[model samples]
Target: MRPRFVLPAAFSVAAILLLVSCNRGDLPGKKQLESEQVQASPVAPVASSKVVEELPGAAVSPLTVEQRLEDFDYMWKIIEENYPFLEVNKRLNGEDWLANKEEYRNKIAAVKTDDEFFRRMRFVLSRLNNGHTNFLSKEEYPWYLNTYVQAGFGYEPWINVFQQPNVLARYNQKPLAEQQSPNESNNDINSGEAGSQTGKTSGNVKKVIIEPDQIAYLGMRSFEGSLMEMDSSEIRDFLIEVKDYKTLILDIRGNGGGNSSYWRNNMVPLLINKPITYNTYSLYRGGEYAEAFMQARWLTGGLLPIANIKDEQMPNIPPEATTMFKDYNKNVDIVTPYQSVGFKGEIYLLVDSSVYSSAEGFAAFAKGTGFAMVVGGRTGGDGLGTDPLVAALPNSGYVFRFSLQMGLNSDGSCNEEVKTVPDVEVDPDTSKPLLDQPAIKKVLELAASQ
Candidate 1:
């Protein structure tokens, strides 16, 4: 168990010194103020980004099939030796991982062109159960991201975590068996029950015909990225007139991780300005312990104003030490001071096993701040701080993202193994789409009743 620490008493918006050495030519906002007072200091740049360099004695891809196999072997060797987690081997144990690796090799080896080889490589990486593991040549990552964005289920991008649908389809694999029907004529097939099963192959899209009086729902997938960038304004507009609905369902199901600022910038406006201490940080030993900083209680400044952090004067500390203090203070810094807003509406947040990383941080914060009711499944087993550190593999030139700093929730509990358990436990129906699930239906029903 990790020892707990409260955010030091010295931490607050008010405690932050607003040092301004202004000139008439200066502009408004935090950056300008800081620039006038102190020299701009950027964080030490990461030296190792992903690069594509030819390996020694490696065949330049227009090589024979045997050479392609050797290339894959070299990449796997790099992953085995350099992967940060010692237990990564356990996850890849048994014939399954090897079988997939061979399948990828075969596909690549049989490819007639470079495009086909790239496609095979993507298939290989996709099989690696997604812990920031990948097979992209850095140039391909952006395209992959764009491809994923294009494959959307709806206007809002999200994940589908239903297991029953997959299991049942596998159990009733009629399509796989239908190809052996050489004896049957088209008319004969149409007369049989198998024809009816064909229509069922495609999944159903459920529609929730919500009334203006009925409760409206919005599920936050995660809280890490820029809230303004996410279609939050569309959600915000929907929420603005949400008083018509008796209840609001905000599902955080499977949302396990993200930054706290995502909440302060995006969510606070929708609710009553409840002044709550969200979370605190405890630096690891050997880290700098600095003077306290604080900000005063302020009103909703929208996204722009809230993000506008004014500069502070340095306390004449050492150059290196001063820079370290600034970096540490940025994460622990409370840009918007605590204040109150009166929201008369009720809110419910649905949580599930996928809620992890920064999503878990947001959930813990929501619970701590009394912003919403947490309902549904338990979170993905991760509730700690993680500062992403990237490392390049010496042989393959592949980049690996590793967690550096551990995070502590407001209550100082880090559930790396057990995860954040939901307050309301409801099993999701995997056989049905999320819109048709019992939990979402229940939320709507409750809202209607109210």
Candidate 2:
């Protein structure tokens, strides 16, 4: 379970829109986020002893070449033993990562200093091409994991490193907490004030008029968790009004996911009455974090555990003979229509490369179930699975992280690789507003033709 979409309990995204404002270019590393320091502070619990602390101007012979090689082997071993995307990566990239053992070792052996080693490690992990699996700055891990806890992942933190609510406020970088919001203007629709085809809803929701009563628009910026205290009256009123429209445009671009449940609970039910079903399979290894997350009853039983699988979904299954896959039991979610009249129209989900994690989950559902006609660019995948697990290099105290589960679509394809393809593709015009992008314009034309 990758907690990229999960967070600690105290977080609140109780509005209509998905929230979180990370640009695709801004994420750590795009996964390797560093602040160009010789010695970054590695947190305790994961690494406290023998940690070659990169103190300010302090000379320290961090690790011998042999020790560094051992640490490299440790990193390699854990990923080989537990990480689930090896086969999928091989199938998608046509490059077998596990087979590159000697190649990676040679690269690791050449890096002399701690900084060089860290940079080399980044190059090695980046080969996976996964957003969630990367070497994390220990300074950023707590906030990233806390993001999962608040997003309602419902897991016990095994390492005890994530106790702060800093919300990725480390590295002396601008905090993402302050950056997590979509563009909103006064007279937004959710506010219920008079407006010229535009108004704001709470949280990540925005509404606009594309064709008045015939066409309406809604956008969710992120899927942050637990909107427990938001007043329902405004949202319900908007939903009641939106239900009369002929079509709804559901936008989830730049929605770097927080919690999958936010949409499962808050946005989905109101608009959907009949069941929206899809099959999602995942590969995982039994570890402390994965087991604890499962034991907490977070899975809710749609995923049936299967072992020693010889299937096309994961053709290059992990080298580990005992690796396992959790086959989804065909999840069927039926919700009572909001006010007995869900949106009496079609839904078109707008997407782009920025759509990821739980948002990609939403796009997957739309694509698989035909619940919504997806529009725009392919998504930035990694939508399936649980929150990520963190560990540190014993020698250098360099922390690394990744999801325990590798999610697969209804078909055998890996979610992280295939992503969600658009039904009606259109290049978005960044110069225009979300409501008036080229995709929106194309969708408008499509709706007109209908």
Candidate 3:
């Protein structure tokens, strides 16, 4: 059975006490938190550890190398036993699961410092191709960051306001408007050159066409890597140029989330006029009731501080660039509602099961504001809130992530267990053009009726 999401009895009481104190404005000072940290369980218990007797393949190594191999032999053992993914481990194998450790150990000595070990370890973990799995040491626990949490945006793009053209009443805004009426082209501003329209069935898009009359249709693939390091000018200019279209269709069908702040910054310009209240996230404990039941040791064991939340709001401390959290927070900039581009026209967003994490965040934000109409399959990931936590093992220093923060919708309801539902349900209709031109069709259909 799936591990039910619930905290123990004692933990509940402590959480309640802490929450009550905070609510009453009897905030616990740093000393109190420090004291709690000191008293908290440094280690959480898991199943018994199993030692692997032999390497998977007949690979011999030096004594130090062999010992390093053995150390990881134990490390993988502990993780498989304790990790939440029991079924996945069964398939990965009790022995071969240490493939990364062995591969790294075969290359470098295990006797190397923890820093060198983990640096190589992370590279190896990345090879696993599973975003959820990772390794971190307890010592490095304080500096770990699981979420692509952003602080805010550094630059805001400029937006232009233009009088929206009605094709039925104006006939000058339709596709081939230029070819149809030379008079309309004389005074009309050319926002951009009409590119050759490409039509096909790709991964998520059902059917879509690029043409002179259609607003620019954008498809964002994966959301990973560094945004601050990349140039945003091109992206900004692209969105600005597309603004001349009657309606923009943004498709995020298979977007497995990356850095939240990155999307926030990129999408801020598209969100016109006012800042809408985005969804809220909280830790996923069983709420007030579960808080009353959790034990002290379990409550603090492997527990981490979530970045920010509505209730357990993270306070701004002194900047520490050394920590990933601090660095990310400092680099992140939120797009204030009032500072957004107020696009006067309609916007359409499409999503599907592959849409997750930050993609869901983007969809959720767009959904909350009524700025865009979502049309496609429902999102696979939760729409409401997320408990963001990070932790490391004590002995091997293997880093890992857990759903620490639970998320809430704009209405403050729990959505962790429930994935985001679509406004308009759709399946990938491959017989048609890949990009679903439902938005364009809707507009065209409405225009034809008039």
TM-score for each predicted model, relative to the true structure: 0.45, 0.69, 0.45
What is the clash count for each candidate, in the order shown?
32, 34, 49
Per-residue lDDT of candidate 3, residues 1-450 (tens digit): 111111232112111110000000112233553232211111111123452211111121223445445555554554433332232223332323444454555644634554444444444443322233444333222111111111112101000000112211111122332233322332111111111012211122222335555556666654332321231333454566665566667777666654444355455544566534433433333233223222321443433443343233333221221121210111111235322455565677877766666667667767766767777766644332222223333333244433323344545433333356666665623235553445345534433443
The weakest ten consecutive residues by lDDT in model 1 span: 17-26
Candidate RMSDs in Å, in order, are 20.9, 9.4, 22.0
On TM-score, the leading prediction is: 2
lDDT of 2 by residue, 1-450 (tens): 111221222123211122221223233332233333322211322213465543211133456788779988988887876777776677656658789889889877887776677777766776665666666563445444444443443444433323222212222233334543311311121232222124433454666776667888876675544222232334555667778888888888777775565565555667776655455556666544455544553553545555434444555334432344443333333333333346768888889888887788788878887878999988888776655665666666566666667666776566777888899889944568756688888888877777
Local distance difference test scores for all models: 0.38, 0.58, 0.38
What lDDT is obtained when candidate 2 is compared to the true structure? Answer: 0.58
Rank candidates by TM-score, best first: 2, 1, 3
How accurate locally is residue 356 in candidate 1, as Cα lDDT from 0 to 100? 59
Top-lDDT structure, candidate number:
2
Report RMSD for candidate 3.
22.0
Give me the displacement of residue 337 in model 2, in angstroms: 4.0
TM-score of 2: 0.69
How far does residue 446 in candidate 1 sit from its true spot (Å)?
Answer: 6.0
lDDT for residue 177 in candidate 1, whole number 0-100: 34
**Where does model 3 exceed 4 Å of error?**
1-214, 225-231, 284-342, 382-388, 429-432, 435-450
| Model 3 alpha-carbon miss at residue 21, Å | 36
